[model samples]
Structures are given as structure tokens and as C-alpha cells.
Target chain A: MTRAFNFSAGPATLPESVLRQAQAEMLEWNGAGASIVEMSHRGPEFMAVAAQAEADLRTLMSIPDDYAVMFLAGGATTQQALLALNFAAPGQTCDYVVNGHWGKTAIKQVGHYVNPHVAASSEAGGFHDIPARSSWQLSPDAAFVHITANETIHGVEFRDTPDVGNVPLFADFSSSIASEPIDVSRYGLIYAGAQKNLGPVGVSVVIVRRDLLERAGQPRADIFNYRSHVARDSMLNTPPTWNWYLAGLMFQWMLAQGGVQEFARRNATKAALVYDAIDTSSGFYRNEVVPAVRSRMNIPFFLPDDTLTARFVSESKAAGLLALKGHKAVGGIRASLYNAMPVEGAQALVAFMRDFQQRNG
Target chain B: MTRAFNFSAGPATLPESVLRQAQAEMLEWNGAGASIVEMSHRGPEFMAVAAQAEADLRTLMSIPDDYAVMFLAGGATTQQALLALNFAAPGQTCDYVVNGHWGKTAIKQVGHYVNPHVAASSEAGGFHDIPARSSWQLSPDAAFVHITANETIHGVEFRDTPDVGNVPLFADFSSSIASEPIDVSRYGLIYAGAQKNLGPVGVSVVIVRRDLLERAGQPRADIFNYRSHVARDSMLNTPPTWNWYLAGLMFQWMLAQGGVQEFARRNATKAALVYDAIDTSSGFYRNEVVPAVRSRMNIPFFLPDDTLTARFVSESKAAGLLALKGHKAVGGIRASLYNAMPVEGAQALVAFMRDFQQRNG
Candidate 1:
């Protein structure tokens, strides 16, 4: 059966081809007679899968050789606490730039482990844009500078990597990791939850500079220790094997799509098609995020009147445009066009939006 | 394709029927036209799946309504830390009974959050037997008592639940959660990683008494807070959706197989078949664990002459008996007969053992 376009913020859509391959191999992987999920992590079969995933991801992102890729659990939210626990000692502070919901969540989670200094925040402007880097207050002895590259809830994204001078720059790129090209050398660490662009919801990928790995501070439990994960090659414990396997398939699928450059061009086209409908609708539909900082992945928009919101969602569902309901915190419609969303799906959504606007306006 | 009879300790074999069903619904679940993996956790579709899973597990285990069944991440190892961080404050102590590798790992992890008291241990006995309850050194102010019901590595199991009087009891039921009937009312918490009797490796089942929910000390990070998980129904963060979904299927499969009573009978027959071979081998094969506390899930044993150990593994693999290699810590063979392992699989192992004994004895 053909799959529907799922615009869920997470546990999101995956490429049908990847799912097909995974399903075909769900019982016997590579004629090994055992599913990849059933294989031991330390075994050569799974080690090859893990290594290949890292290699492909590195190539796609142009990851520096100085960085170590770690597949971890606990999502990016756990990374929020981990970042502080690893870098910021009790007495030390870290710089956190708050742009939207994810950034704010990072700040709150980090505060539990260390004193987090809010360097710059776009909350004053309702998190519709990234705070200017020039407005950030840098701490000379700060452990690191943190940011969320894309806010799925607010449909805001950072078009450029922040220049944090000497302090290591860390990003929670959960919603934006593979969406476009990135300069791996610009950051000390970059992590993303796999639900959106990667594969499943269990694994989180963390890329850390080799030098910064040693600064992961005092030893913690095996699960929480970044150094332990890196040292053991992310097999310190039984990993989410099936999730990792699915992610490996996703990496292969991404590669088959002509890698990152091709993905960026396709994503841009999909985003523009939807944005064009919202823009041309005049007073009928309006996007909340600033045009310059608008996300190419998630497009959150509003109807001219609040009364049409429920109708829009209900109608969209009937039209098979699912999960277009905006985040509760941001009341509007949100269309998340992640990597798996085909151009036709986006076109269908754009056409539906145009028709709805014409009939309502 | 038929999957192999995988004997991995954890991240072990899944029920072939469950894998078939999952593969059938990979792209479209029910009539949703979206995979369960891709569905939004909060959406009615997945909420129904999650709720049904919890309901099925509760029924299968006869879990009380007052208990909160949580689908969590990071496996049983994470639960050790969570149990410590939630139940015991920094200066307080919790009692831990150590029998084998899992128990020792739990003790070490609990040390990260609380000073765990070694109330009883079988390490002095080479971890081949469960310590008698009478020999335990209990602490009056202990927050709780933790035990591993079945030690997957050493093939030691607590045949009976320990009585902790008024203090709550917690069991890491990772290897034997659904293998037999459990007295849910006797314990405050029962946690299991899905790899063994459950489903996969990424998701863990944490059933906690409702009253113990607030014992989660303080608000930690979202991932570590048991209260946050209970409050959000394990959707506090995007859960390991696919793993949880597969676990739900496993729970349903358990119910279909006549629940724990039927499982207990099947598991007993399987274990007895293997153990009977070892017992009658006459100095050829030796299982060290006392019969009273021998595990029905994992059967760890050794050849009288250790020189044949490599040959055993090599010859077993040639017969398609894979992953029979014991853990490094225990230099012998271990066959983990989790709930998914067919009785035929165990019989095959026993047959192989008997044939080998006849040839070498």
C-alpha cells in the first residue's frame, strides 16, 4: 500500500523505499539468517552497519575527522542536560541562545545541571526569528555556546551557523540536521534526534570534536557518559539495534538521492511551493515566522481568522493532508516537509491550500 | 524468509509472527495509511496502540490498576539509574541483591545516584546460585530492595520473590518478564528491557506503583524523570515509537499464547530439556547453578574439559546454532531461551549437546 504523507513533528515520515528495504530484511538481514535487530552489537555484521552509518553521515555533513560520531539514546532533550553535564562544571556557566521552543527547552534542561547564561533570546519577538549573533553576550570562560538550528514548533531556522569566536559551538539540530549543507568545523558538537530526518525515535546522533570528548567531565553512568559512548564506539550497552539498522538504511537512501546537495535543492523546491501558496493567498493565509528565518522543513501558518483553524485541520484531514495542526503553543497550521515528503505530497498540499484560500477568501 | 533461532543474550530473537505482522504493516497500519512508527504519539491512532499495549500487558501480568506502566528508553541499565535517582536521594541507601553480571551492573549504576547496600550477594559462590533470603543483610531505612529475577549470563534466577516487609521491592525482569506468572502486588516496581521476553532493545517497560511516582525526588531532566514519563504516558518525549509498537505486538502475542501460565509451561519444558541433557551427561556437560535457583530463561553451562569450548562454539555454528558463545566474563556456553524462542530451538540445542556428549564422553 502507498503510504500517506505524515507531517508529524516526530515519529515522522520515512522514505517508502527505506521502509520497503527494512521490511524485506526484517527477518533475515543480508542473508545472515538473523535480523539486524537480533545481531549482537559487538558482532562484525552490526559493527559494519554502525561504521557505515557514521561514514555516510560524515560524508554527507562533511564532518571533520577530528570529530567522533556517537549514536545515543534519550533524544536531543537528554543531550540538553548532557551538554551541561559534560562541559559545564557546577561552578561554571554556559551560553544558551534561545530562539524557540526547542532552545527554551534546552535552556531549562541545562539549568538543571549547570548555571546557563541566556546570551540572546528571540522570545521578546515571539521566537519568530533568530536573535542576531551580534546581540549575544559571550562569557569568556563559558564552557560552550548552545543553539537549536531549527525550531519545529515555531517554523524558524538559522540560515547560517553562529560565529562563537573561541568557545565551542554546540547545536541541537534535531529538526534540521540533514536538511542542507553544514560546515562541520564551525561547531564543537552537533546532535540530532533520529525521528525527523534520520529514521526512528529511539536513537540520537552526537558528533563531538575529539578534544572536547575528554572534557566530558567526571565519570557518569554508562548511558549518560559521552566519553564512554565514544570510547566503546556507541556500543557501551545494547543499542537500539533495530533503530540503528533503520537509520543505516536511511543513510543509504539519502545517499541514493544524490546525497545532501540534491536533498537541499529538492527541499528548497518543496518549501517554496508551499510558501508560494501561503504568500499569494494575500489576507487568507499568513505564516508567522520571519521570511528570512522561515524553516524549509516546517511551515507554520495561520488563517486570517481563528474560527477557520479547526475547519482547516478537519478539512485537511479529509483531504489526506495529515498532522497539519500547529503546535498547541503556536496555534495555526503546520506542514512539516521533512526528507521523506515527496515533491508531489508538497504539491498536493500547496494545491489544496490554494483551493481552500480561494473558496474561503 | 524465516528468521534464525537467534540466541543473543539481549536484543535477542523476536517472535516471527510479530515480525511478520509488523512487516505487513510497515507502511500502512490498520487503515491509517501510515506506519505505526510514523504516527504522532499524541494522535488518536497511536494513542490507541499505546493504550492497548499497556492494557494488554496489565492483563497478561495481572498488574494492578494503581500501577503506572511506562514505555521508556535506554533499556534496563537506564532503569537502574532511574530507580536510584527516583527512589533514593543522594545520602540515602537502597538494598541490592547481586547474583550475576546484570545484578552487578545494576549495583554499579545505582552507585551513581545512591549508596546501594549490598544486602545479599552470590559473587562469593561464583554467581552460580541465588543468595538465600535468610542470609540477606537488610537496612531498616533502605528506600527499596532491588533484585534481578533472572541472571541471563550466569543462569541464576530467584525462584521466589523476596519478602521486604514494608519496604518496596523492585526487580529487573529484563530476561524473564513475561516468561512466567509474576506476583505484581508484591513489588513496587517491575522493569524490563524489550530485547528478551519483550520485543526489541530500545524500549523498556517500567511498571511502578502510582504512590511511588512522586518518589522521583526532584524534577530532573525530562528523560530521567519517571514522574514526567508517567504524567505524559511515556510520550514525554518522542518515545522509541517502533520499539514500543513492537513491544505492544509482543504483549498481544503473549495474551494470544494464553498469557504467562502457558509461557511458564513452555519455558519450563524447554529449560528442563536442556538441563536434563546436562544433568545426565555424566561428567561431560556441567551446569553450575543449583537446581532450585536455575534460570528457566538462560541455561549457562560448561564442558568438563575447557579445551573443547572453542570446538563447541565452532561446531554448534556449523549446525546453525549461533550466538551460543557465552559471555566473556563466564567462559562457557549460554543458551538464552527467551519467550520468543520456540521449544524446538531448545530441543535442538539439547539434541546437539547429547550428540556431542555421546561422541566425546
Candidate 2:
């Protein structure tokens, strides 16, 4: 079967090998006598799988011993609230660098827990470019400086982690995590919803510096507290077991493909293919992102004729490319080249783009 | 191939038909040429799935139109906190009926959000039976009266929903939902973790009365807000999609098997086989739960000698009955007969138990 390339922003594509392995072991896992989904989280069978997944993820990112890694429910959206509720004491200020849709949402959600100060925002520029690091107005009294490392909707990405002196830097690495190598020590905490580059839906990974644990807010609710989950090894309650197993499989697959460094190299090559086609389209197509900060994971392009948009999406889908429709907030076309999207998928998209441009232009 | 009977408390057994259907469509669904996991939640394909699931569940429970059904993240433990945060204002009194382990946990967790009132408790009896309805203490000003419909650990079940006049009743039905028909209108809200009868882990079902939505507390965070989830059709953010898909399949399977009425009949028969074995054993095995209040879903029985517990679990495993080791809080054997457990599985356990008692008694 010639499988369609899925370009969904989330609940997105996963490595084909991982899918095949999951299919083969749907009912039984590694002769454990039962499926991973059917095993209790506290049992040795599922515990070993969870431990391996955590270990592999730690290895892939070279996570420091000072960090506590937690697999939690709710994606980046919930983390938006949890991060603030966990870190900020009542009336404490938190800095947020708002660039795109998710970052803006983060600012609003976090406000329910603390006073969120937008240290910098790209709204004035239509989110085409990130605010320069030098221009960021982080406060010395802030508990943490929040940043969306990659914006899936507007296709903007941060090239480097911002340095906030004496303040812990928190980042939502949802879309860009594992796309490249990262330094664990640079950020106080990092969280990613595991739908795009990771594995599947239902689990989000939170890695926080151990020191930050001592500074968590006077928790209003036990379930919202990160400290409790850390104390119990993220099993303070029954976790999403099957998602954890699949994520472990993903970590193993990522390691087999030479870790995130190799992913970085391949991602760059894939991103360039789509960008080159759009750049050379001679006004036939346009990508609104500032070239310097364009996301390698998501690329949004616009056709010169608005009427051509529907035809492009329908035809591209018919040609075995799927989920190319842009987010409703940002309309045009979006090709999400997540970690699992093969280089061939990008090349296929470029070819389709060129064919459409030639006939339409 | 014959599959082993899984007796784990949760992330537990699933109907064979559900597993087979999931495996067959692992790569594609509805001839869409894409896996259901690959479908976008907002797209018509997955929407149809989400819609059908909601409809089937509403039909199964006879949920009134006034109730809003939501598929959420976090487990029942989280729901304990959410129920308080969403329904109770600061310092508002909420009554929790603590009959067993889960109820006790709910009382403690809900305290994080509101002043919890223990209307009735069975701790004096060591969680052996439900407190009679006449013994419950009522609070006219309570936010909601909470109950654990079925206690998974203690093996005690409420034969009927408690009447908390004027005060909306809330239930954590994680272990007992879909095992039999329910009167949805009696409760203001019901939430269940999907690991038991529903399917795998990661998603939770929340059925809230629409009128109750108007009384929500000051918003703590958008993602945790029940009102936000209901307004957006529970797509407040990317939900646990794969779990949702499997749950939809389970609901379809339940409907095919004559709905909850059939499940109730089968479960009662299964419970009878295990209970009868212990009752007729002449003190070799004992179930401390009072006969009338014992749960048909979780039946915990103790051996005459505690030293034989491990051997019993090992022997049960070898005999194809898995995860029968009781909760550490309650030392014994616990067989969880969810909707998926075949009647023959219960018979097999009975036959094995009679033999073991004869040899060891």
C-alpha cells in the first residue's frame, strides 16, 4: 500500500515502523502474556515499559540529573495552566513571550493562576517574526519566563533559548521537541504534548529542574500539583498506560535513527525542500514567516489566488497527501513536517506545489 | 487463539470484539485510507466517531438531554478534584459519602478545592459494607453530594444511588459504568476513567447536567473548566484521541450485546459463581464483604492462610486467570468482572478455586 503522508498539526504522523510493531503486538506484548494496554501500571510488565520510555527519553535529550521527568495528562493546553499554577505563588508575576496562536492562548490560560506579563509579543507584526531576544522585557521578580519554542499555526520557531538572568525559563516545546538536540540545563522546565514529533495523543512530557520543585505554588488542588506527581513518579494516579508504551517505542525508534541530531539534519533537509519550492514560486505562493525564524516542523504557504486554496487542498489530498488544510485561524495551506514525516513526503509536497503553480499561475 | 482472562483492576480487560476490530483497522478505517488515529478531531471523519460515541453512551445510560457528555483527560482521581473546583465556590461545603478506598481518597482530594463534608462513612466497619441510607447525614447547603458508585479496592458496591434531596449528586463510576443500566437523571454529574469496561487508559467520560454548568466556580484555568469543554464539544484541546476511538468501539460492542441489561445478567451470573465457591468452602476461603452489598464487579476473597496468597496468584496466572492479586490495601484475591469478562472465565475460576481448597484446606 502506498500510504498517504499525514501533515496534521497534531494527533499527527508517527513512524511507520512503530505503527507496524504496535499492530503486531496489539494483543500481546513481548510474550508478557497480555497486551501492554491490558497490564496494570503498578505491575512489573508495564512499569518496566514506563521506566524504559523515561530512560530512553532522558538519554535522547541528555536530561540532567537535576531534572524530574513526568508523563502527564492534558497536552500543552493544560500545561499552560498547570505550569503557572505549579510555579507561581499567589500574586507572583510570570513572564510570557507571546509569538503565535498557542503562545497567546498560554498567556490567557496562565492568567487564571497568576499575573501573566507579556514580556514580548509578535501580535503587532502578524506573528511573522519572533520578538528579538534583546527586546524581551523579563522582570527580575518573575517566577518563570514562559516561551513557546515552536508555533504550529503561524510557522514561527525560536532558534535559541532565551537567557533570563536569575529567573527560571519555562518552555512549551510541544511542536519542536526532539526535532533537534537540546541543552537540558538552559531551561528550568520543558514540556511537550506527545502528538506531533513524539508518538500519539493522551500523554504530555514535563521535565523540570529538581530545584524548581521547592518553589511550587501553595497548590489549590492536588491533581494540579506537579510536586505530587514527581513524588509518586507520575503514578499519583493511574496514567495513560498505552500512550506511555507507544511513547517508549517512539523513544526507541528515535534512538535507533541516531537520536535528535540525525532528526535535525533530516528535518533541515525536508524543510528546505518545501521552503525552496515556495520561495521560487515567483509570486505564485507566499510563506508569511520571516525566513530567519520559519519553523522546520510546520510550514504555512498562501496561494496568490484565494479561490485556488480549496482546489489545492482537495487535489493534494487526492494525491495521497493529507491534513494540508491550514488552521482556521490562519488560512491557506500548512504542511506539517513532523519527525515521522519522511524526506520523501516533503519532496512529494514540493512536486505537487510546483505542478499546481504551473497550471494556476 | 484463546485469550487469558485479565483481572487487573483497570487498564484491564476489553471485549474480544473491540480488540479484533481495532486490530483489523489499525491502518485504515471506513475506507478513508487512513487510520482513525490519523483523522483530525475537527474533521468530519473523527467528528462522526465522537458523535456516535456520545450518542451510544447516552442511549446506554438513558442520559437525559439536560446532561452534557464530555470526554476528558486525567482519571477519576482527577475528577474528584475537578468536581470540587468546578462546582464548589471557595469555602463552600461539599458532602462526600466515604464507604471505601476511592471514597476516602475523594474526600481527601476534594478538600484541596473546597470544604468537604463527610455525610456518611463506613471506616468504622473497615470498609466491609455500605453505610445504610438511613444513617447518612445530610447538609442542605452542600454544593454536591459525592459517592463512589463502586469501590474497586474494598469490593463493596452501592446497590442503588443515594438520594440527596435538592443537592445535586455526583458519582465516580469508573469501575461500574456500563456494567448495567443507570438512571442518569438521578445524578448531577458522572465521570469514569476509561481503563475498565470502556477500553484503555488516557481518556475519561464526564456527563454533567447542563443546569449545573451555570453554578461553576470562579475559573481556575480554561482547560480544567467543565464549561469550556462542554461549549467546545470537549475539543477544548487535543483530547486523548486513540482512547476515544477504542471507547467508541467498546460502546458499539456493548450496544450489539443487548446493552447494559445483558452485561448486568452476565456479571451477576459470574459474580455468583465466585461468591458461591467461597460461601460453600467451609471456611477455607472468605469474602468479608456483606452478602447484599458485595460488588458484582470486584469480588475479593481471602485464603485461610495469608502465606498462600502469592502461590494462589501464581497458580491463577498459570491457569490463565491474571491479575487476581488483591489490592495491597486489602490482602486477598480480587477478580474484576467487567463487561468484557466471559461467563466461562468465571466458571474456570470457580473450578480452580474448588480444587485449590480441596488440596490446601
Candidate 3:
């Protein structure tokens, strides 16, 4: 079967090896007499699968012992709401450093639960770059300072972690997680929907400092309580077992490929190839985001006109490349170079860009 | 590939054909160039897949136009909490009928969000039978009357929907949905985790009357709002796309097998085979639940003592029966006969039971 190079933002591409492995075990997993998807999460078989995934992730990310990790259901948005429910007192102020669409969404999710203070935002600049750390209006008694590690739609990313003094830092690392190495201890909590760099949709990973579980944040249902999830080892209820199993397969693949350090080098090379193609297009293509903070994981670019943009999307699919359409909020073309997107895929796209530009320019 | 007759509770057995189809399409889906799991939710390919799944489910369940259905991430517990957050005002009274483990857990999830009054409970009698509807003490001003349609652990199921007067009836149909046909208009809302009767572990189906979305129950995030999810067509955020697709496959399979009426007949025959074995065992085996309300889906029975229970579990596994061990709360044996479990599987289990009793009695 022919598989194309898919560049959809989240719920993005996965490693072919992982998919093959899943197919091989779809009916009966390793003599357990049922597919991993069909087994009980609390059963010894799935429990071992879940535990190995967490242990491998901890090793890959170098997570500190003071932190607890959980694999939960739903996307990153659910966690955005829970951040307020599990950390802040009712109507307590929480600092938000807005970079782009996801940052704004994070704030929108908790408006009723917390007084969200926009400490700094790049929205005025059309989200082309990160706001300067010095310009942030820090809250003295804020529950936590929130940031988007990468914005999938706006194509912006944080180049470095900003020091917010004594307040804990919370970041949405959905798109760029595992693309490179970062200090896990720098943030009080890091959460990501597993559809992007991780394996599949329906499950999210939350890494948090153990002490934060004692915050006594606000009155809410037990399902929304992060501490309860941690206590139960993310089996607070029937977890997304198939998704969790798929993600665990991803962790194994990542470690076997030399961990994040190897991925970081490859990511830099792939991003540079596509950016170089855009730079040399001589007005045929333009990427609006500022160079300094342009996201390595997702790059949104534009053709000279909408006519050419439509042609590019249709032609790209014909050329065995898929999902290059931009977000509806910002129409054009977007290429996501998540961990699963091979370097050769990026190279192929760059070659196609030059050929298309030569014909149309 | 000697597949066993798997009898695990929720996250239980699946139709073998469904697993084979999924395996065939793991690498590429319907010539879409990428696996369905690897595509964006907003893309046209998945949009069609999602739409078809919903339509098939509606047909299979005979859902009416006044009901809005959603396929969401997470299991029934998440919806248990959201029921309070989206439909009831903070501290508004909600009447609950508790019969078993799941019924009590549902209450535990919503304790902080609503005033959960236990209107009737069979827990005092070890959940051996469903509480009599005539004896219920429902609240006059309750936001809703909640009931567990079937208790998976205790093997107690409601033979008919209770008429709870003017108050809207909300039922957790996680274990027994689609096992039989019922009038959709009888309940204000019905939610089920897809693991048991539906399909897989990660996705849940929520069928709610349209008027309920207008309630401004309490302050909550945009993601937590039912109105917003419905407006976006359960696409307010990235849904568990793979789980949704799998459940869709299940719908197609059920339709091909002549829908719920056929399943109901098969289920009755299967339940009779097992229960008859228990009843005729002359005290070697025992099922304490009232026969009239005993679940056709799950049959939880006890051996004469602890040693026999452990021996029966081990011997059953060796005889190609899997996951017969009971839940920790109530230790014995449980044989879950979901829609996916074939009639032959039930017959095999009965034959094994008769042989086991002869050897151990």
C-alpha cells in the first residue's frame, strides 16, 4: 500500500514501524488471546504496557523524581480547564503569556474559574514572535504563569523558557514535545495531547510537580482533580487503552532512534531545508513569521495568490504529499514537520516547491 | 491464532471481524493515502468518516431527530461529572438511584458539583436486586433523576424504564446500551462508554434531548459546555478520531447482523444457558442476584469457597476462557457476554462449567 507524507497539524503522522506492529498484534497481543484494545486496563497485560510507557517516557524526558506523570483522556484543552480547577482558588488571578491561538484558548477555557491576567501577548504583532519577557506584567499572587510552548496555527514557538521568579510555569507542549530536549524541571507542569509528536489521539500526557497536587485549588468533581488521577496512576477511570498503547509504542520508537538529541539535530536540518526553499523563491513564496521564533514543528507559508495556493494543495496531494492546507483562521499553506515526518519528506516538499516556483514565477 | 472466549468486563471482547478490518486498514485507509488515525479531524476525509459513523449509529439505535448525539473522548465517569456541571446549577439537588459499584462511583464523581441525594439504594442488600421504583424517594425539585440502567459488577439490570414523573430521567447505559431497543423519548439523556456493547475503550456516546442544551447550569470552560460541543458537532476540540472510527465500524457490523432486536434474542438465549447452569448446580455454584433483574450481559457468580474460586479461575483460563476473575470489590468470577461475544462462546463456557463442577464438587 502507498502511504503519503502527511503534514496535518495534530493527529498528525505516525511511525510506519509502530503501525505495522499494531497491525500484527491487532487480534491477539503477545499470546494474551485478545487485542491490546480489547483487554482490561487493570489486567496484568495492559498494566505492564502502561507502566513501561511511563518509565520509558521518564527516561527519555529526564523527568525529575519530584514530578508525577499521567496519561489521561481527551486533548490538551481539557487540561487547560483542569489547570484552573486543580491549581487556583476560585477567581484567583493567573498570569497568561499569550503567544497565539492556543495561548488565547488556554485563557478562554478557565475564564469563569480564574481571573486570567494577560501578562504579555504577541497578538498585536499578529503572533509573528514571542513577546519580550521584560514587558510581561507579572502578578505577585498569581496561581501560575501559563505559556504555549508552540503555537500550531500561528507557527510560533518559545525559543527559551522565561524565568517567572517564584511562580510555577505551565506550558502546553502539544506540537513541539519530543522534537528536542528541554529541562523538565523548568516548568511546574508540562502537558501535551498525544496526537502530534506522540502516537495517537484521545490520550494526553501530563507531567506535574508532586507538590502542586496539594494546592486545594477549587471545588470540583473528582474526575477533574489531577491529584486523584495521579493517585490512581491515570486509571482514575477506564483510560483510552488503545490510544495509550499506541503512544507507548511511539515512546519505544523514539528511544530506539536515539532519543530527543538525535531528533533535535534532524529537526533543525528539516526545518532549515523548507525555510531555505522559501527564502530562495524570490517573492514566489513568503512566510510571515519572524525568523527568530518561527516554529520548527509547523511552518505556515503563503503563495503569491489564492489561485496558486489552491493549485499547490491539490498538486501536493497528487505528488504523494497530504494535508498541506493551512488553518481556516489563517488561509494559505502550512507544513508540519513533527517528529514522525521524515527528513526525506521535507526534502521532497522542498524539491517540489522549487519546481512549482520555476513554472509559475 | 487460537483466540479465546474473552469474558473481561468493560474494555471487553470485540467482534473478530471488526479487528480484522482495522488490521487490514492500519497502514492505509480506503485509499486515503494515510491511516485514519494519522489525519486531521477537520480534513474532509475524516469529516466523511465521522459523519457516516454518526448516521449508522442513529439508524442502529433508531435515535429520533429531537436527540443530539455526540461521540466524545473518555469513559462514562467523565460524563457523570459533566452531567452535573452542564445541566445543574451549583449545589442543585439531583436524585440518584444506586444499585452497585458503578452507581456509587457516579455519585462520587459529582459530589462537589451537585447535591446528590440517594433517592433509592440496593447497596444495603449487597446490590443483589434493583431497588423497587415504587419505593423511590425522588426529590421534588431535583435537576434530574439519575439511574444506572445496568450494574456491570453486581449483575443487576432494570427490566423497564421507571416513570419518574415530570423530572427528566438521566440514565448511565454504559454496559447495556444497544443490547435491546427502547423508546428514546423515555429519557432526557443517555450516555454510554463504548467499551462494552458499543466498540472500544476511549470513546463515549452521549444521546441527549435537544432542549437540555439551553440550560445555563453553572460557570464552566467553553470545552466543558455541551452547547459548544454540539455547535461544533463534537468537534469543539480534536476528538478521539481513531476510537470514533472503530465504533463506527462496530455500528456497520451490528447493522449487518440485523441490529439490536437480533442481539436481544441472542443475549436472552446466552444468559439462560449460563443461569440455568448455576441454578441446576445444587449449591456447587451460586448467583445471588434476583433472577428477574439479573443482567443478560454480565453474569457474576461465586464458587463454594475461596480455594474453589481461585481454582476455577485458573482452570478456566487453561481451558481457553479468559478474564473470569471477578472485580476486587466482590471477589468470585464474572463472565461478561457483550454483543461481540458469540453464542458459541457462551455454549462453550456452559459446557466448561458443567465439567468443572463435576470435578470439584
- Model 3 residue A338 CA deviation (Å) reads 0.6
Q: Give the TM-score of candidate 3.
A: 0.99
- Which scores better on lDDT, 1 or 2? 2
Give the fraction of true interface contacts kept by model 1. Answer: 0.63
Distance from true position, residue B164, model 3, in Å? Answer: 0.9
The DockQ assigned to candidate 3 is 0.88
Clash number for each model? 0, 0, 0
Task: Give the poorly placed runs of model 3, Cα more than 4 Å off.
Answer: none
lDDT string for model 1 (A1-361, tens) is 6566778888789888888888898778897778887877877788899889889988888898999998887788888878877776764788989999888888777555677899999999999888888889989899999988889999999999988999999998998888888888899999999999886779999999999977846335666778878889988888888888888889889988988788899889999999899888876888878899999999999997777888888888888888888889988899988888889989999888888877877
Q: After superposition, how far is residue B157 of candidate 1 from its true place, in Å?
A: 0.1
Local accuracy of candidate 2 as per-residue lDDT tens digits, B217-329: 85578787899899999898998888898999989998998999999999999999999999999988899988889999999989977778788999989988889999999
Best by DockQ: 3
Ranking by lDDT: 3, 2, 1
- Of 2 and 3, the candidate ahead on DockQ is 3
Candidate 1 accuracy as TM-score:
0.98
Error of 2 at A7 (Å): 0.7
Q: Which regions of candidate 1 are displaced past 4 Å?
A: A216-219, B216-219, B305-307
Residue range B1-361, candidate 3, lDDT tens digits: 8789999997989999999999999999999899999999999889999999999989988999999999998789999999998999999999999999988998998888899999999989999998898899999999999999999999999989999999999999999999989888999999999999997889999999999989888888998888899999999999999999999999999999999999999998999999999999998989999988999999999999999999999999999999999988898999999999999999999999999999989
lDDT of 1: 0.85
Lowest lDDT sum, 10 consecutive residues, model 2 chain B, at: B30-39
Candidate 3: interface RMSD in Å? 0.8
